[model samples]
Target chain A: MHIEVVANIGEARSDDLLHKTVIVVDVLRATSTIITALANGCKAIVPVETVMKAKEQVQEGDLLGGERYCKKIPGFDFGNSPLEYTREAVQGKRIILTTTNGTRGIQKSMKADHILAGALLNGRACAQAAIALKKDTVILCAGTQDVFSFEDGICAGLILEELTYTLGEKNVLINDFGLAMRGSYLHSKDRLFETLVSCANGKKMSRSGFHDDLILCAKSNIMDQVPIWEHDQMILLPRSLARSTF
Target chain B: MHIEVVANIGEARSDDLLHKTVIVVDVLRATSTIITALANGCKAIVPVETVMKAKEQVQEGDLLGGERYCKKIPGFDFGNSPLEYTREAVQGKRIILTTTNGTRGIQKSMKADHILAGALLNGRACAQAAIALKKDTVILCAGTQDVFSFEDGICAGLILEELTYTLGEKNVLINDFGLAMRGSYLHSKDRLFETLVSCANGKKMSRSGFHDDLILCAKSNIMDQVPIWEHDQMILLPRSLARSTF
Candidate 1:
């Protein structure tokens, strides 16, 4: 299997993503929030590129969830925080989500054969989901404003590490960027929270009072569910179906 | 002290580099060769972006050196290999040099306050030179064909680690990409040659009979000299002058 880890959405070519499984990672909030919502029983997440599109996609029963610049969109149920995506708040509801980078990444990967939302919370599960899909993979780190972000790169490293572990090192062929990310992940795995805290977004979010979010997103493999794109919405990959495909 | 580690030439913005000290790294050979040539008593290296420019710049006593697709240009004096630039061949002689990526990187960084050639062999010296220049630094990894390469990224990491060690962590402010590279460098410092051999360019160079070059380029901080852009060419920074700036 071949894995190419793109540094940011700006560097990702849609043509390269074609016929491949693209894992979109936004650990500073987007993908992490998606994974959290799904794991906490959100029915589905419709990720759109713009706030207006997210509003248009919403139906009577659906919840509008997203952020613009790390703040909750006006009249939306929540910001881009996993902690806000509790079982009591999101259970059995569909969410129309739009954020700065993560949703834009998913939109850019529309041509991919499979689009899986990946974060540290579900890194191993995302790797397994890609394996089950049986396509060359592209891990797109949804960096901030087209610049590479440490949290997303770290999440990409976690998924690449998981893929290498499950597929065996010899069976996996990773691009140089992925290889660097894997090394970065291995070096910082022991102090993930501290690592996240040291990055730009981490410091921004911490100053903005999202310290708990950093702690939540820094934990690896805490959730076994993977959110996969299907029919214009992201839903959990059925556990039994994923296992049987292995 | 602020530092930005750009993944490739394509991603570097000229405005961000203005007034900053830029260290251009191409560890698969470009900067490494330049460092070796200067350390071996080469007078100066004029880095150009094209074969025609290299030829045009050559004087009566100048040596023409460059590579096209990892092979020596048909009639050049040497290829992009440090070993080929022996003291007997390059002593007190100017060289007109061009390569696929590294020269392009230096060309792109013309707006910077100072531009220095950096590779694993001279990473520490390059870091010290940047400190002596007393400007915010940008480590531009001259990746292959606008994509990130492991060797260059590792060299950037090595330099970042050196800067952090000398300046102290609290005083040195690094961007997220630089942080990732520093982590990667720390992780693979013990087995750099193996790490390089596993990367794409490394594998290509090894298969093309440049195995020795890989071994030579993988050694960290082997050279105590740095090549800085002065006037229109790259020359060794005077050790006394650099020390005096400190």
Candidate 2:
């Protein structure tokens, strides 16, 4: 029942998250994109580490959805924005997803016994699911290029708060970085998104004109569908697929 | 000034810590060894990444001090424990040091414009020296093999606390992780030393009978002579020859 939220997949790996139930978050778009795609009825999301891998993995029926620097790859089917993962376009189809940070994060977590995709969009659902699973959980924020990202930290805080709220504090074992993320979120709850954009990773995304994507990605608990990773594939969970999933 | 505490040397590199002044901490003994060697009156500490390089670099005048794990190597002059760095032994002597974690961390911070050694024993001095330099600082925790170690996090918290107290909150840019380490210290202040031994790295040390080393390493603010990196060598500050530097 311990909860550890590392700054990124790198930090998560350093924390020895292999045997733990890991929840990977890339709020700026990977997790959000995958969550949105799944919520819209996409069958399953296949996350690949690199764009080259994504391109090679896609079959005739699968679509490529990812970005290099928050922009769509030239030949990919769609960009990394969640707005691109709509019901009409992605319904009932498999997607080969890759991104600069997110997919590589998932690939790193491939060794975890349980790897769950998490984001502010589906944060609550993800937390509740982790709590229900009732094991030690490691929240891995897929930070921008292994550096700390305010967006990822904020989203990790939301997940920490949610998990702690649901599971109680005694069950939590937060690392120093995780504690700071929770404190940052609680202290700046009102301006989390705006303040986040000023951080190192946030500024990079803003300069890339992906600020709008931040708005979409930062809305806490907006989406109820928790994208759970099972057997190396990301699929909609029972909670996310239930009648009240919307 | 922005102050970030990366959990490991690897994270420090990924975060582009080269742009800032880096305070490297390997609390379980590398920094402790350096601090002790200096405290014991050692002239300078030459940090090398690997044992082979450390062995290769020492000359006729320099003494070699370091360890691979808890055990001292067969031919090495000393173990990593600070207690072994007695004043009579190290006085005015140069020590070529390498350890499993600490020396590697110092080598990693070679990319940084300015690098200083940090430990719980010298946390205040390290913070004050970094602030005196008036540069953005990054506290690089040399966590055990790239993972978050509780002892290093606590030491980082001690540095952050010292910095915030001396420089005021407005003068520091506290990242989410930094804030968390501060919170962690506050939450467990009464039993800080007890908490340290319970950590992953600390327990291993305890089990290996180096528990005394942990206690020695955990003492806070014992010295005022902060060691700084100059010309790839860690020496006491102030370029004056008359200064009683180790």
Best by the TM-score measure: 1
Q: Candidate 1 — what's its lDDT?
A: 0.92
Tens digits of per-residue lDDT for model 1, B1-246 = 999999999989999899999999999888999999999999999988899988888889999998887788998999989999999999999999887798889889999999999999988888888898999999999999899999899999999998998899999999999999999989999999999999999999999999999999999887888899999999999896455222
Model 2 Cα lDDT, one tens digit per residue, B105-214: 77777667788888888888887777777788988889877777777878888889889998897777787568656655655556666777767667778899987887
Top candidate when judged by lDDT against the true structure? 1
Pairs in steric clash, model 2: A14-B147, A179-B180, A180-B180, B42-B246, B43-B246
Error of 1 at A130 (Å): 0.6
Output DockQ, candidate 2.
Answer: 0.14
Model 1 alpha-carbon miss at residue B46, Å: 1.3
Fnat score for model 1: 0.85
The TM-scores of chain A alone, one per candidate, are: 0.96, 0.90
